[model samples]
Target: MQTAGSIQAQMVGRSGVVATLALCFIIALLEGVDNQSMGVAAPFVARHFGFSPAQMGLAFSIGSLGLLPGAMLGGRLADRLGRKPVLIYSVVVFGIFSIMTAHIWDANSLIFSRFMTGLGLGAAMPNLIALVSEIVPDRLRRTAVSFMYCGIPLGGAIASAIGALSVEGGQWRHVFYVGGFAPLILVPLLIFLLPESRNFLASTVQKEGRIRPAAISTVLFGERRTVLTIALWVTFFFTLSILFFLMNWLPSLLVRQGIKPAQVGVIQVLFNVGGAVGAMGFGWLMDRTRAWMVVLCTYVGIVVALVVLSQSGALGMIYLGAALAGLFLIGAQSILYGLSAVYYPIVMRGTGSGSAVAVGRFGSFFGPFAAGELLAMGFAPPLLIGAAVPLIVIALISTLVVVKRPVVKN
Candidate 1:
């Protein structure tokens, strides 16, 4: 096994990279469960509190509100305070609030708790990406980063299964109860299991003395790196918009098409399952290529799948189309993350990725809400197809930018 010093000699430090990433992945795994709790628990929580669908939607939107600030702030914190500390603090804080959410008795309390929990939730993601980017060597960075994201869908998958089987098993508060304790269980493991981001350590320290963790920078985004940032964020934006529309809208569409509720649940499971498959496979493929062709194609596939799903008559075909869309649509966007670590240097990695992801979160914020509003308006399939038109345009834009110039700076 290569030591950290050896990694410095080569592009990657092999020894700790595997272990550190595993630790990050595990932490992210539980954190993933935490992330999906709101959506998974929304219906039950709304029933318990007598919340209207609109109110539940607003409750969900509040978290995004926190996420907006958190994304921007987390990027800066990861860059400034160091990835490990920022992640540790954020994870612990989120966990506490998550547990507290289970106890909330009213809409005001729940919304306030969710918003606070989201602060921690929103804050944690950027640093997690930053940490992954910092530890892996330059060549393997993309592959490693992609692997790290597998935690997201894995977490979501676990949530899906729990959500599906336990779909209506208990009070929705139980879901939050589950989310709260999961990360707390990881706190000690993270403290001991996960070390500081290696590059974060390297960039800040020297033979002279100890250095502050946040004061480091990589050469990825020097003064020359300008145009690339814009392109990356553009891809990040539309890709998420595509994925969010499906995750949020597809179920209602299926219900509208006269599918049974149980089958709709099954489709949701497949959607998440396909996402897991895409992310898991993406790592191996990315290890082989630079352009991340899988991601580009997936965007196109998502568009096509959306069109197909819109018109699907057979239940089997509907399921297949949904799975395909999930596979490419959600998975393709995450591939960008994998690509981010590959393209950026360690110093600016967190900022670059977080900024792109932060902007993308805006797409996430509006995409689902807009789709739901449209669905409520009786716009029909054609209008929804029109909504999807932007994705095609975004795909072309991403293709030009990602192929020609992949990396960006904060």
Candidate 2:
């Protein structure tokens, strides 16, 4: 019998695997573009709709609300039905809704369109992570996964570029139109080119009559992994909270910090550029060293970067700080996703990653809203940015706990 591992071995170094990675990267890029589109478009959207900052914050957070359910439901469906179908369906869902966003007439309608778009975006993520994990060789796992995730920051950079263009002459709705229509166009390519996860078919469905309850249960409450799972969730939550806070509010916050309006996009692009570098570097380090150690050190870098950002005195310093922050913060999150890929068994990998992402989405929701509230309360930007320090410390502790736990392979 060809076990999942053996099947993976056969696929190592194949051109098809490279193609798979490329397509997955593009999918992630689209998700990133859509994800950051709102942040880039926020000021414009608010201006058009006469929205308060708080209302804009709500617009930012509400999409994450849809992500929560979409992730949970999508994970379960991917585990049962198959990763390919669920992934394709998610792309279609997000693409169509993103297009619909271009047509919204009011704030409520905008929020509704975004929330629906979130559902598709959320559904696609775990499956992408899980699929890459299943397909790549063990030696290349971290690197491949990290490379795939680089699309996220790259996508964000693309959004910032679009934002810059919008500032020049384009409308914000054009951003939505591009975000929506591109994914719809990609659907056909995905259907024809994307391969189903062989490990999932071989190890999950064929070997077992059906997905066992233990498969799902073991990821959360299994004896060897329970503590690790909890710690992973904590790490994901804090990191994502920080990430979303910056993603949704960084442009506006920089505007408040007296940054030149034109320079805002440059800073955003630099942030994501650093993120891509960090993702690849951390992935290389994790493959070469202890993952937990790499993760711990990365969080430390994040704390230092945040502190620097809070007290930056010059444009150069602020740009450097933003780059460092994106490097470690976003890189650390990518590490968590890679960890989840390696941590769980094939049977429930999608569920495991989805659940973690779902939890992180709550942090995503909280980060922006809390920042808005704090701003409303007249908190300083420095204080607001520095607040993440303690959360990263807590994440560091959780990672320490995870490191001490035994690896459980199902």
Candidate 3:
């Protein structure tokens, strides 16, 4: 029979894991709010500054450009220093710049502030993924990570609701204000409540000073990891291209399509709401069903949603299409993130996750910029929406290849 002390220890361990997930979820939610802030406020900001389509697109892409370096550096630093301190600093950087976004006097200032904010957000992501991955057992990896990921879309939904409320008032700056302050408020809680990953600590003791350039190359390209890394990069690139494109452009596209701002907010909310549901639902399914099945369902749903969105003119159809798109697009991203966390050993998990995210940041940067350029060149919104289908198909194929390889849990 198990001893009472052993039973007590197990309960404490379970509670600790729950607490960790809860904290990570809150941070992820804040990140999502900030991530979606530009999209929610774009129309109003455009009006405030008289930004052209190309210029607005540039602003969107500039912020994401910060993410590339931030992710690379943040992941590297987390491995060198630790996840908690790095995450704390990242939150502070993003929060301050996010508030600065509310006070920008010109387009130049706005872009700079947003870029700084994205830098902070970028840094936080890999740490969050790494931290959560370490805390959970292999059996619950997808489920745990997916649960944490759900907070992101839920946060986006909250931002969309705020946008809906502020539409008539033109209070666009309030979105940034909320996004800024909430994370700052949560900092104190994180400092006191969050625990550092035991796995990270254990790895540090076992292999001190292994974060060399040579080691990184080996982790990424050595031991037959080359193909896996390439597949991951391709999957992240194409999938995030479509996902970010929709996120940054969808609201503006709806407005241009003659949808009312209020209705557009509703559609945005549905999109994020669908995303939240999909993140959890698909994540759960991944743990139980075949990985290829999830991939097929996710990408196929994306294609169908995009087609429906492109063809739909009525408000109801638009909402349905947007929701479906959100469901699959965000769901697919969560799956990719979970896989990224699982693919590498614990020692290099931060680096692996960070590098993949940085590459995805490139996609995030290009997607909005490309969409903006095309729109400025007089491409129809429907055609642009449909264009994402080809990218999704490519990502689907790459993801299938990735899942076929067996993963060894660290």
Best by TM-score: 3
Provide TM-scores for the models: 0.85, 0.93, 0.95
Ranking by TM-score: 3, 2, 1
- The C-alpha stretches of model 1 lying farther than 4 A from their native spots are 1-15, 205-222, 249-261, 290-292, 381-386, 406-410
> All candidates: CA RMSD in angstroms?
4.2, 2.5, 3.6
Pick the lDDT winner: 3
Clash count for each candidate, listed in order shown: 5, 0, 0
Runs of candidate 3 with Cα error greater than 4 angstroms are 1-12, 206-214
lDDT of 1 by residue, 117-224 (tens): 877877787887877766755666656666777777677667656766664666556667677888888888778767677666555433344333332233324565
Candidate 3 per-residue lDDT, tens place, 242-275, comes to: 8888999999998888888899899989999999
Task: Please report, in order, the local distance difference test score of every candidate based on alpha carbons.
Answer: 0.68, 0.83, 0.87
Q: Which ten residues in a row have the lowest lDDT in candidate 2?
A: 205-214
Collision pairs in model 1: 7-13, 12-137, 80-214, 217-347, 218-347
Give per-residue lDDT, candidate 1, residue 189: 78
Per-residue C-alpha lDDT of model 2 across residues 1-410, encoded as one tens digit per residue: 76664575455446657767988999988888898888888877777778888888888888877787788778878888788899999999999999998888888998899899989988998889877877876776777789899898988889888888785354888778778998999999989878777667666644354554245677677756777778888987888889999999988888888786568889889898899888878988988888777977898899989999999879999899999998998898788777777777778888888888888888888888888888888998889999989999988888777666654343
Candidates 1 and 3, the one with greater TM-score: 3
Global CA lDDT of candidate 1, please?
A: 0.68
